[model samples]
Target: MDVDARLRELGLELPTPMTPAGNYVPAATVGDLVYLSGAGPLRPDGSMVVGKVGDGGLDLDAAREAARLTGLQLLAALRAEIGDLGRVRRVARIFGMVNCAPGFNRTPAVIDGCSDLMVEVLGDAGRGARSAVGMAELPFDIAVEIEAVVQVST
Candidate 1:
């Protein structure tokens, strides 16, 4: 099946591509690779999803959900730029930042939120190396932020 159909099968909907909030583009292409800038968890209504992982405000489970949402938004941005998700050749990497309490131990699990979605949509080929780090704070104080490198069709 195609990308749209894959998403439909998974009951996922892409959010509107969010404009960069600062001095950066949402995504850029260098050769055939698209580098997506960090995308914070954004609600369907276009509001930031705020929290810190492992804190009472946002635990591991909540952070995972946020990462998943951010991944979908990233794909939405990709489709907005390329006009079709099928143009993606493969996912190269993902950088995940999770705002969390000092002792948070589930960074990998939180990042799985995004990873699982990529696997679902792009299968094994979409899997990529990932970095999941805990930070004292993140842009907009959202639970998670995701950036990616994707190889695209010519």
Candidate 2:
């Protein structure tokens, strides 16, 4: 199936590409690799979804949703840059961050939301190594943020 079809099958719609919050571009390509800057959860209407996971300020479930949303946002960035998902060969790695309580230990599970969706959309090729970490806080109080590297057709 095509990328659009897979996305629809998973009931996800990509949000519009967000402008970089700082001086760097959202993504850049080097050879066959596309490196994406960390993306915070963005609602479909362009507003940010703000809350910290396990902070009592946000629930775990919501954080997972935020991660899933972040994945979609990354895909949107990929599409905007490359013009198509078919150009993607494989997702190489992802780094996920969740703002959390000092003792919270569910970082890996929260990041699974993004990992699972990548596999759902791109099948086996999407499977990749990942690191999930907890932070005292994240920019804009976002629940989750993620960045990725993928191999793409030249």
Candidate 3:
């Protein structure tokens, strides 16, 4: 599929890639695999969707949107690193983290936001193994964060 065209078809615009907040690079390519660092719910205008999930924090829907936005952030970084997303062979795996109130266990449902977008954008190549976990807090208290590993044509 033409990934750029797909984004336009979906009316989804990728955010500008953010600089690494710490010491590490946003993505690293080892051979044909591109390992994406964790990205938060950073928006196109340089703001973040920050809050906890469940309970006294964001509702499930809001948190899910946060995950979707984070997915966009990761995509932006991936494109910046690789120059063309068309080179992607498949999305290998996803690691999603949700900042939540105490005892929130519906993490997977929230992270499905990002996962679903992957399938929507990349089709079969976007379906991949994934893990979703809850965290007491995340950097900047962003609602969701996601990291991915992708296999690409060399």
Candidate 4:
């Protein structure tokens, strides 16, 4: 599909790709699969969404938005690595982590923000295996962090 066109159709634009927080590269490719490192919710200006997400903390809806933003960052990294989103043949997997208050159990629901965006952008090719879990903390205290694996056509 025309991935760049699809983002505009959704009224979304990719932010500048983020640099790695540490010594790791943002993406690595082996054969046709590109593995993305975790990405946080970085705003267009580069500030991050930081907080614990859950009851009496950051609102779930806001956390979901953070996840979506994180997803956008992942896409940015993916495109940077692969040259074009059209190179993606399938979204193979995702690992999502949410920094949350104690006892929050809706990790999957919150991560759907990213999942939904993938499906919206790539249709069925974006449907992929996923795991979402709550965490006590994440790098920079970001509300959500997501990593992805995508299969691309050579």
Best by lDDT: 4
User: What is the per-residue lDDT of model 2 for residues 42-149, given as tens digits with 9 covering 90 to 100?
Assistant: 877777778767668778788888888899989999999898897889999999999888889999999998998899889987898899999988998888889999
Q: Name the lDDT value of residue 24 in candidate 1.
A: 88
Cα-based lDDT for every prediction: 0.87, 0.89, 0.91, 0.92
**For residues 37-95, what per-residue lDDT tens digits would candidate 4 score against the true structure?**
99999988778999998756688899898989998999999999999899889999999
Clash pairs, model 3 backbone: none
Relative to the unseen true structure, what is the C-alpha lDDT of residue 68 in candidate 3, on a scale of 0 to 100? 92
Tens digits of per-residue lDDT for model 3, 1-154:
6999999999998888888999999999999999999999876678899988977769999988889988898889999999888888999999999999998999999999999999999889999999999999899888988999999899
Off by over 4 Å in 3: none
After superposition on all CA atoms, how large is the RMSD of candidate 4?
0.8
Q: By lDDT, highest first, what's the ranking?
A: 4, 3, 2, 1
Candidate 1 lands at a TM-score of 0.95
Worst 10 residues of 1 by lDDT: 46-55
Off by over 4 Å in 4: none
